[model samples]
Target: MKLLMAAGIALSLACISAAEAPSNYETYYGGVRVDSDPRLLNHYNRVLAYCDREASLPQRGSPYPYDTWHILALRSCLYRYSFVDRGVHSYPANWFWGHVFEQ
Candidate 1:
């Protein structure tokens, strides 16, 4: 019975650690999970802020004129920022699975 209890405790700990582990995307995209690099993380946050500001700005031309362009530009900037910070060229292929399986 003692052995079984110890095993159960170990298993629970393992599950907790696994759940807390950073996802591949967080590590890959802009190093958000990187606690050691505050500078890079701050820059990533600044970029996101800038993107939000730009997206919220009103355009003067046609209705929704800059919507497509803004989205594309923001996406490009984010991808470039992530690549620069994390040195990862591609998004995690398993990102979807990670979220689905976690819950």
Candidate 2:
């Protein structure tokens, strides 16, 4: 039950953050343009999968949790892929927060 509650809260936060996130801004990583939406989506999905797997692992004495790392990775991927000027927001279903709860 605790896990479910935590997941719910995390999801709520993700959705809220997603709502406020900038949209349709061209993204670049290491001075290189990120021109492919599919590539970014793939990276986001991979990070999410890693987060899920790590969340299921036994807790350790580390300073940062696995979820933290994975979430950051996902965020970075999103940051690198999203466009701010284009204002393109057609596929909400493909967004990270859109289906985070379904995992």
- Expressed as tens digits, the lDDT of each residue in 9-76 for candidate 1 is 76543332111111222445444554446765566567766654554554511224235444444544
Report the lDDT of model 2 for residue 75: 45
Candidate closest to the true structure, highest TM-score: 1
Task: Write one digit per residue (lDDT tens) for candidate 2, span 5-98.
Answer: 9998776544422221223334453432333466754554564455445544445212343344443444444444442222323233346554
Worst 10 contiguous positions by lDDT, candidate 2:
16-25
Q: How many residue pairs clash in each candidate?
A: 0, 6
Off by over 4 Å in 1: 1-35, 57-76, 83-103
Q: What is the lDDT of residue 46 in candidate 2?
A: 61
